[model samples]
Target chain A: MDMSVLIALPVIIPLIIGALSLVALNNHGVQRILGVLGTAAVLVAAIVLLWQTWLNGIKVLEVGSWPAPFGIVLVSDLLGAIMVLLAAITGFATAVYSLKTVRKRFERFGYYPLLHLLLAGVNGAFLTGDIFNLYVWFEVLLVASFALLIQGGERAQMEGAIKYVTLNLLSSALFLTAIGLLYGLVGSLNMADIAVRLQQVEDPKMVTLVAMLFLIAFSIKAAAFPLFFWLPASYHTPQVAVSAVFAGLLTKVGVYALYRVFTLMFTGEVDFTHQILLWMAVFTMLTGVLGAASQYEVRRILSFHIISQIGYMMLGLALFTPLALIGGVFYIMHHIIVKANLFFVAGMMYRLGGSFELKQLGGLYKKHPGLALLFMIPAFSLAGVPPLSGFFAKFILIKAGVEAQAWWAVAIALFVGLFTLFSMIKIWNEAFWKKAPEPAIEVPAPYRNTALYWTTGLLAAMTVAIGIFAQPIYVLAETAAQQLLEPQRYIEAVLGGAK
Target chain B: MTTMMAILIGCLYAAAIYMMLRRSMVKLLIGLILLSNAANLLIFTVAGLERGVPPLIAKGAETVVGGSADPLAQALILTAIVIGFGVLAFAVVLLHRAYEVIRTDDMNEMKGTD
Candidate 1:
């Protein structure tokens, strides 16, 4: 199989499916089947791409064969391949979950097509080697997400959409400004070309200034400290399926961009740039956990946790060593699976309890023990319980921080983990263990949605599998970290020895 | 020319920020438009202004003739403008719909979810 087509499939397949779904918008059944099949195809393509990239170093595809540094390129290394695969998995799960959860009114508004388009944008953002193309893909995703967020046009959704759109538009403007300045300085928009040209830039301060602009832009996207207000403010208002997918994949894209640019383009000012990142990571961690602790709503707490977990990944990047980067990569993989599963559980709890407000719900353990146990898996995993995925993710990061002699970071990571457990426990007590405050008004005897439960259970099972089989995945993450740390192979592969 | 454009861009950014910070959703949309145009202008001015000549080659020439504008910057700004327009259109419709549903344009009043 040609690796170029394989590298391109993750992006191309989704766009094709999205367009097809758009045409068949009136036929809900056909759209559902197409959405499922489309995501399945993307998952297979992403897996094959990852497998091939593992065997052969990096795969580069130059559109129209215009040659490196001039043509738009799609380069898939270990990191990009990993992200694409995770996205495909998340997309597939969300598509299945949406089949049961998304309202007919929303689906009639072309939900399937918009969701697939968002996936295409995500995969394209991951695969693009051209920086400007990354911006375009970001727009593609943002537009689709804006539509999806306000699909039903509810008051809450509209309010959230306003904030989401306004803030994201501002971020996009900043991103464009940064790209323009970078092009002015480097005379190139291809990432590898920029890296090569950036080395010759005489004024490091100017480079640092541009780097800060990029940091702010991507940080807003990633929902880092002081810039994360939009995330919790908007995330909880969307449908569970929407929030689940957004929770799993959206902020991770921002983290991916941050890692890509910092590791590849801004290494010259690591001391200045990464130090700011390090402080941001600490504040992000502290504020996120503290915010989660104060939240009584299940989804809002989960949304805040997303910000907190992002801090751990940023810490890995700020440390900027192979071990820390490995931890970061592993954390991203672990967090996505666990976070999405937790949101799915929250949805089920809503079905069971009739509200997301923790104080209004109870008796799930007495009624549905299976749901309680299933929820425990991801909830405990998110709080870093032993022998689950989150524990390993936190352990590796804390170990890396300790090794880096960043004791303050280690302390913060540990403290945040404890508070995370507190919030998780709060949810457990309120939603499952505590007795129902009143007789369940309209609660069904037994939950019967196989699609939602199966998807949530499968993801929970994956968290366990990743934890028990952590060694191989760790080795893969180590390789990804090495690739990020040493960019010679990446540059050479993309430029074809031009440098 | 570059310095004057830089100052203009700076003013646009300042006005955009000011409008964006207003409580009304309409002001935010206006701010986004200003900011996006400011970004396009920034790209154009920073890439350097070359007038009179177009970025085209003589019929048999291998490369673009000298003293022509950088076609890449123009192409980038064009793409940015189109994308910006699509987003702005979406924002306008979304805000209109939001206003219809929520019955308020003030951002603080629209905090039903939070």
Candidate 2:
């Protein structure tokens, strides 16, 4: 089998399945089956891709055989492959969760197809090597997300989608302008090619200017501090499945781009650029946890925590050591699983308790101790509890910060963890432990969707497993961080064979 | 010619931002349209303006002639324009739907979700 064909399967599988599901759009059963099978297939393909990339080094596939520096290339290094694998996991879990929660009306209106398309877009974004191709992939995911967010077209979803659409489009425009400026400076769209060319350029200031453009554009997508209003405003408005996948995959793409560019191409002015990133990391942590602490709605609080956790990942990057990068990669992997699982648990709570408002809900501990247990795993894991994934993630990052003597970042990160714990405990107290303010409607046993619990429980188990088996994953993150720090290997792989 | 194009692109960007700042959703849509065009034109201008020469390979030639314009930038602009158009189309429909559902064209009134 051609290695390139294997490389393309992650994107191709979901795209083909999405189109096929569109053909069967009216049949909810078929859509459900296709959605599950498609994500599972992509999951299998991603596992294979990750295995091959780990066994070998970076895998590059040049589209149409146009050769490097001219054609679009797809490179799956360890980091990209890891992101794809995590996306597949989230997509598959969300598909199973959706089987119970998603209405048939949404299925009839092409929810399954759009979900597959979003996966395809996300996988493409992860795998593409061309800067321009990355922009196109961003649009692909953004459009699919816009459609998915507006599904059912309730008034609030409408309002949220409007902000989502406008803000994201603005970011896209900025991304395009930056790409244009970059092409003018470097004359190549291939990221490896640009990295090579950019080093030889006479003007460093111009490079810094374009770097700032890319930074601002990507920060909006990553939902870093001040630029994150669009996130909290809109993320809580979508369907739980949509919000789950978005929470897991979308912003991470932006973070992945930041890691790729800053480490690979824009390392010239690290003192200046990374200093800004360090400050951004500190403030992003402060503001996001504060925002989460103030939110009473279940998903909104989770949404805000998404921003806060992103701060830790950025801290890992800003610290910019091999160890910090390892922590960053590990944090992203753990955060995706834990965050999406948190949303799933929230969805289950809404199912059993009948509202997302923490104030309106209570007494889950007595009625459904099982559900309370499910929530506790991911919630505590998210709050950096010991022996869970978030604790290791935060530990490594703070360790890296301390080693680098970034005292402010270290202090702020520790402080934010406390707030994260506070928010989690607030939810625990309000929704699970406290007395019900009113008589809770009894959800019958049959309404307790076994599939939902199974999916959420499996993810919670993965979080615990990642924590227990942290050494092996830590080794993988170490290798990935090493690869990121040393870009010559990546460049050699991409452009090495070219004449 | 390059300077003129640069000035025009700047104006387009200025106008787009100005319109985007308005409270009307309709103006926001128009601003998005202008903003995308500004970006398209910026790509064109930055890649260096050329007149009359089509990026083409002569008969039986292995590559385009030396004087022919760079086709890659144009191709990039073409892709960006198509994507921009698709996004703006979606934005138009989204804003319209938002208006119909929220019962207002004023962006301030759309704050109920926040």
Tens-digit lDDT track of model 1 for A381-446: 999998999999999999999999999999999999999999999999999999988755566554
lDDT values, one for every candidate:
0.92, 0.92
> How displaced is residue A62 in candidate 1, in Å?
0.5
Stretches off by above 4 angstroms in model 1 are: A444-447, A497-499, B59-62
Worst 10 residues of 1 chain A by lDDT: A439-448
lDDT measured at residue A2 in model 2 versus the true structure, 0 to 100: 76
The complex in candidate 1 yields a DockQ of: 0.89
Residue A431 lDDT, candidate 1, scale 0-100: 90
Each model's TM-score, in the order given? 0.98, 0.98
Tens-place lDDT per residue, model 2, A180-265, is 99999999999999999999989999999999999989999999977888888899898899999999999999999999999989
What is residue A260's positional error in candidate 2, in angstroms?
1.0
